[model samples]
Target: MWEMAPPKGSRLFQTLGRRPVLRAGYAVVIGVLVLSVVEAYRIQVSLSGQHEEIYRRYVDEEEHINTLRRNLWQAGNFVRDFFIRSTPEQAQTLRSQLQTLQAEDADVLQHLAQMSPPSPVPPGVVKSLREFWAVLDPVPITMLHASNEEQYDFIQREIVPRRGELYAAMLDLSDADKQRLRDYDRQFAESNGRAAERLLAMLGLGVLLSLVVAAFSLRHAETLEQQADRHYAEVEEAKRELQQLSGRLLEIEEEGRRRLSRELHDEIGQTLALLQIQISNALAALQGQPSGPREQLERARSLAERTVQTIRNISVLLRPALLDDLGLVPALQFQLEDFQRRSGIACEFVEESVADYLPDPVKTCIYRVVQEALHNCEKHSGSSNVRVTVRQRPGSLEAEVADNGCGFQLNAKGMPDQSRGLGLLGIRERVALAGGSLEIDSSPGRGTRIALRLPLEAQPQPAPRVAAEVPA
Candidate 1:
């Protein structure tokens, strides 16, 4: 079966499309340059042919005109000799030359009829040739009849003057033809010059286009290199951030261990020791005087209850049960109350609930951030009042903490001085881990405010609420 071939134009286009852009551009430019060269050469050849033809024609006409002038001059000389000599022998010789002159004149006329005149032959010159022939027609006939004196007078007076006039006309025509030939030569020179100029322009344009293409390619490569460098720099920065995060986490862990050890050793261990002494005293009292042991027993029981409460408070600080059970609102309220009692800083909570259900991670993140913010304000701000607000927007939650306290300048890293601590850094990292953002605003002698936003989409919704507010 004969399959239909694809169209030639489509096939050519497809072949060009598959080539590299630079290669294709070069091909197109080279093709155009080649075409320009060929056209210039063709035009030059054509112009040269035309100029040569004009020059050849002018040469032929000039030569023929010179021959005609020579014949006319020779015929005038022969007649002059015949008229002046007045001898039979001289007369016979003159007659023979005259006959030869007649034959030459006939040949000149025949040549003129056969050949085209040169360009720029003046109309006056053509009329002069006709008059010269008319004047010559009577010359030999008059010579045969006239005596020597009469013939001499006629040759000198009429034939010589007529020949002079004809010669002058032919010379003028020849000069005109020469000038016209020079014009054609000049025109050919100008055309050649123009062709050279056009060829140079085409080559220059092609080179300029190539430079432009090369410049664009170089610029594009530079841009790609810059992008690659930027990407590598970003990767290095991320690695540095991970390292810093790891170090900070280790520091936080160590601090927690020290705090727990102190709590266990000083508070829990002392309370247990004191309870053991109280129990021992109550047992002794019961053994010795049962009647008076009730008061001692009651005091020991109260001390034991206080120790239990202390442990509970520490556990709540670690991870509040209210956060898991009652949700973010109640947990925040409980934390604020505790913060007020411990720091002597009056604290308030405000909520704008956009959605009722809050994810556990989001709730925990917010609660921890708030706790840290309050702690920082208590420790660094020296403030007596603190306000915390949590607002719910579509798909996200925003929390802001502001304190009426003496604020200090933060370092370039946005961390307070080492004497103050790394509490803000901890909060920032925590917020980041929760896929949120944190902003701190503080100035010297002014109050500090920290705002954070956490995305709620990652949280699993368990309930919903419109709004909630807590008073200081």
Candidate 2:
């Protein structure tokens, strides 16, 4: 006997059940597709509601502004009509219109107050409107009872000026609202555009993933690995280019500092030095003369000396020639001495037996880092005691600048802060370019310590100096 055949639906289910992986995959794909459709509908509805609400608010605000304009226009007209009318009936009619205008003005103010919460209307505009209304509300009746000369003076002094002010305020409010509405349009469009892009990307990724799983999972995985490797290589290449660009920028900056320092030292420093010497010579010539001339000479000499000292300090800050002429240690010592003298903040510099021949870049970086750190300490850290230490190891150099002053939170994310400034960031970049790492330790009311560790192997050899030929 032949067995009864199963139903067509049951047979299909049995076939699907035979391949559990395929059944699961189909279910997942269907579920994702349904979810995508539902999400799209929901997003569209949401965007539509937001768009309508924005437009509705925009329309309401625009109407309120138009009403304000109309109110000012009618007010001016009713004021003139009350003055122009001769008969009692005409005056009474104009008076009624003025009263109606005043009522509408109150309504407009109420509307403005309500609109202000949702619109961009400024409170100043509302205040100006109220002020104008206070001047305008009694003008019609007052003009009706006034003589011709009195009405003319009132129009010139109050009505004309106040009306102009109200018009100006309304114009400003209208323009501001229009700008805000345009911005809203742009923001909404951009938001929806981003959402659409993300949705499309997800749908496309899902479809591709489904197709890949159905066909070749292993091949897809291999392809993904290849793509990831390619991306990583591209990223690494970009990073290298960025690093090279940063290094070049740093080199150009140092060269600029060197040029500026030379100019300040050679030009301005010489000028002030010459002035001091001249003042001294003049004083010698005027010695044993009148007391007045001698006192004037002394003041001139004192000013010249102060000017010379200022020029010297500026030259050092711009770029210290000692770093290039002598070494890093001398430059740092000079800086600490200057800082101590100027700020009255005690400073100490400690050093180990550093190698005599250090790369110019390394020397510059080290000097600049210490200088900026000290500057920060002087400006921000109200600490009385600051210490700078440098040590040379077998293969590396380490330096730390510590302050006993008030410290700040060490921000790792590098958010911009004007109070903290870019000194720390600049130091960090300089150290990184030198194949070094920088560490900052600080807390409020405690102290700050900045440690720099640079690799010795990365330091390039200094270029050989050529002796100038002596004249025969």
Off by over 4 Å in 1: 1-198, 201-205, 208-317, 352-358, 382-384, 391-396, 406-429, 437-446, 457-472
Q: How close is candidate 1 to the true structure, as a TM-score?
A: 0.46
lDDT of 1 at 306: 75
Please provide, for model 1 over 96-118, each residue's C-alpha lDDT reduced to its tens digit, 9 standing for 90 to 100: 77667657756655665566552
Winner by lDDT: 2
Q: Model 2, 136-239: lDDT tens per residue?
A: 66564555668888877888898788778778877887788788789988989997998798788768867976894565445435657999999999999999
Write down the lDDT of every candidate, Cα atoms only. 0.74, 0.78
Number of clashes in model 1?
4
